[model samples]
Target: MSSFDYNSSMIKAAFFDLDETLINAEHAHKAATEKAFAVFGYDYSEERKKSPNHISMGKRVYDNLKARRDGAGISEEQMPMDKLLDIREGYFLSFMKDEIVLLEGAREILEVMKRKHIITAIVSSGTKKYVELVMDIFKLRNDIHFIITGDDVERGKPDPECYLKAYDQALNELKDLHNQECIVFEDTESGITAGKKAGMRVVYIPTSTSVPPINYLPDYTIGSLLSFKTEVLI
Candidate 1:
């Protein structure tokens, strides 16, 4: 983690990315994709997943599988996107009870934010169902003031649309809050880019699934949320 400091007192709102950022679900996602492919007598490899052609994370299961089909020369008629998504969702749900878990310091930070009366929201590209599931498992619904899911936005991350929407809502909730007074916590290149583009300070926390070699840098980078201290902001 860097020694960079934050003016926490000035930060009235906080936005967080889901998935690898809040919970350990990346591997479960990978496993679900692989299992879905196997059902159709296809294989998904690490090399292909790491390739530039791989679809970006945080996209709908349908979009990700569609990209995979396109790359594999499989037509939509041969392997329906909806069917693939259904299979993937089933596997993903099965893993949720055991494979997926809250990351270290996740609860502590949320508690700190709540205790300090800071507005907290989840700005994620995940669907409402999945996001709600995570909130239910971790019992975070009360801590989060609002949620902006992929369903709420026409565009996904790396595009500022989602974060911009969140910024607008945050501004509405807090009378004097500005974009700069909002901080975003992210674990992926796309998420970090979205936050910066939305004019919010970003805290980048790398995860196992985070794609590297990003063209841009975040305002702050930390190894994990465990290293984050809200006291500095006070």
Candidate 2:
């Protein structure tokens, strides 16, 4: 929930982080990775996902996973990168198709944002295909303004490339938009850091699975988007 002053601000655009911010991406990613590995008779491990923590992802899921797994010294279980990607993405979409669930108050807040006409977009380190699939599953294909996936950026979160690109896109979509007039909602430290580096205020809403590292703070932190009124910007 949010409570603040109003009537003296300019917040024209709002950017969101997809995974763990709006939807249950952690669960879906885990499910997909598990299925992808099982398809090749390998097991998914937490160590398999640790190598790319600080880097932004700009590759397809297979390449992304391959690199990380190789870096982790577990590349022996790999299959063709393209095939791995197809399998991962297929299972991911299929797994999430029936189980995709929005965070508390997610739709309500989006509806409010829509009614007010504030330009909204998704700035995520996730792949374009996967993000689109998740949006489709959640029935949010047209609910937001746009989505800037890792595929759209040369660099990813913590590098500011994705969020900065998102900011530029939002500006293009909304004339007279300023950096300060944009706010980012994120659930991870890297995402919050990226938003700040992009010169936009950030709201941190931590998810159960991806907790923010200690001391990683944002302009604001709310339990849910429900009480976050647009007027609070003023």
Candidate 3:
């Protein structure tokens, strides 16, 4: 656990997870996966779809497709991961503009961070194109100082690489900011673990009850971003 004094130090920067945290895109993601599986003549199990694994919660679409293919005993020679990923991404991006909705208090929190002059970045397992599309559609480009996507990192959530990279970039861009001064807003256990491992405070906001039990504890758990107050971190 980090020894960050949340009560004393002002939050200098904020990092957010893209999909379920900032926007309600869970259903859209699932639909895209199912569509991709169908195209490849694979049966995406209902049980697997309903049961979200905490370990794979914040992983990339490619990783998820690989896992599914492996589980179904399919080989890359038959169904290439890159091809599967392309299909999945195509389905996801096609209707994501209409299917994605800003989560409650998402804009409010970003606005508060912006008004306070705090650096904000989106650290996501989504691809650069997907994340950029969401930002463009929601007009979040100006609000977000930077973004670190799956395309930008070798490892995804639960590995701390993405968040660490974001924090490192933030340190270079902003003065008087430490990793401990950054608060990560996340909706999945893997994201929380990644943030905590990066030595930052994490606020977990679970988007689904079906999500598996978290392996690591977060600094705070809130129902939604609506309850988040930048001034009163403690």
Candidate 4:
């Protein structure tokens, strides 16, 4: 991890990534992706989603799919990209409805943030529909004030556009919330870089499949979100 110390008092707002950071979406995504593949009439494997090459390919699922499809010459006429995604999201939502895998200490951490009166936001690469479903599934509609989804920005993670946009919004709504005063809780390398590039401190939580390389780590790293003790930041 980076050898940087943040003044706990400097933090005014915290932005969080949605998927692997807050909840375990791997299992749910597996079921949904498989069903989604059938709609595209392609033989699917869980490996397609977990492979390092694919995982690092795009910051958004649709972008990832488009890259893979375009590379394979799978035209929109054949797959109907937009419709395919709609189906995938539908299946994903349906699968998520039956069983939810909340990450360790997610609820407690969220409650703590709320109690501290720290402004919170969801800065995710997921679509609005997907983010909304997860918020509903976790009963977290009111936990965060702003939600910046994939659709909200033209560029994706590692681009800093999303987090920068978030920073601009935070400034409007929060007192004394400058760039350095903001914190980002993220899981992916792209997300970590994006937060840093946006000039905010980051607390990196690594999922089993998305651990970042040590040389380019965030300000802080923890094995699990539960391990992120709030006292340090308080």
| Residue pairs whose backbone atoms clash in candidate 1 | 8-233
Model 3 regions lying over 4 Å from their true place: 1-6, 46-52, 210-214
Preferred candidate (TM-score higher): 2 or 3: 3
lDDT of 3 by residue, 1-234 (tens): 223334667778899998888998877888888888888776676535543465356787667667667766677887888888888888989879778999999999988888888889999999999899999999999899999999998877788999999988998878667888889988777788899999998887877642633577787777788877566442
Q: Which ten residues in a row have the lowest lDDT in candidate 3?
A: 46-55
Collision pairs in model 4: none
lDDT of 2 at 114: 84
Where's the lowest-lDDT run of ten residues in candidate 2?
54-63
Could you give candidate 2's per-residue lDDT for residues 59-114 as a string of tens digits? Answer: 33544576666665665545666677778888777777666678887887777778
For model 1, how does the per-residue alpha-carbon lDDT over 1-234 read when each residue is reduced to its tens digit?
455654444677899998777888877888888888788877777424433542566554555567677767777787788898788888888877777889998998999999988889999887788889999989999999999988888878778888889888877778888888888998878788888888888888876666752766787788888887675443
Which candidate, 2 or 4, would have the higher TM-score against the true structure?
Answer: 4
Q: Residue 119 in candidate 1 has what lDDT?
A: 85
Candidate 4: list runs displaced more than 4 Å.
1-9, 46-51, 54-58, 71-73, 214-216, 232-234
Q: What TM-score fits each model?
A: 0.88, 0.82, 0.90, 0.87
Q: Identify the superior model by lDDT, candidate 2 or candidate 3.
A: 3
Best by the TM-score measure = 3
- Give the poorly placed runs of model 1, Cα more than 4 Å off: 5-9, 46-50, 53-55, 58-60, 231-234
Query: CA shift at 75, candidate 2, in angstroms?
Result: 3.0
For all predictions, the C-alpha RMSD in Å is: 2.5, 3.5, 3.0, 2.7
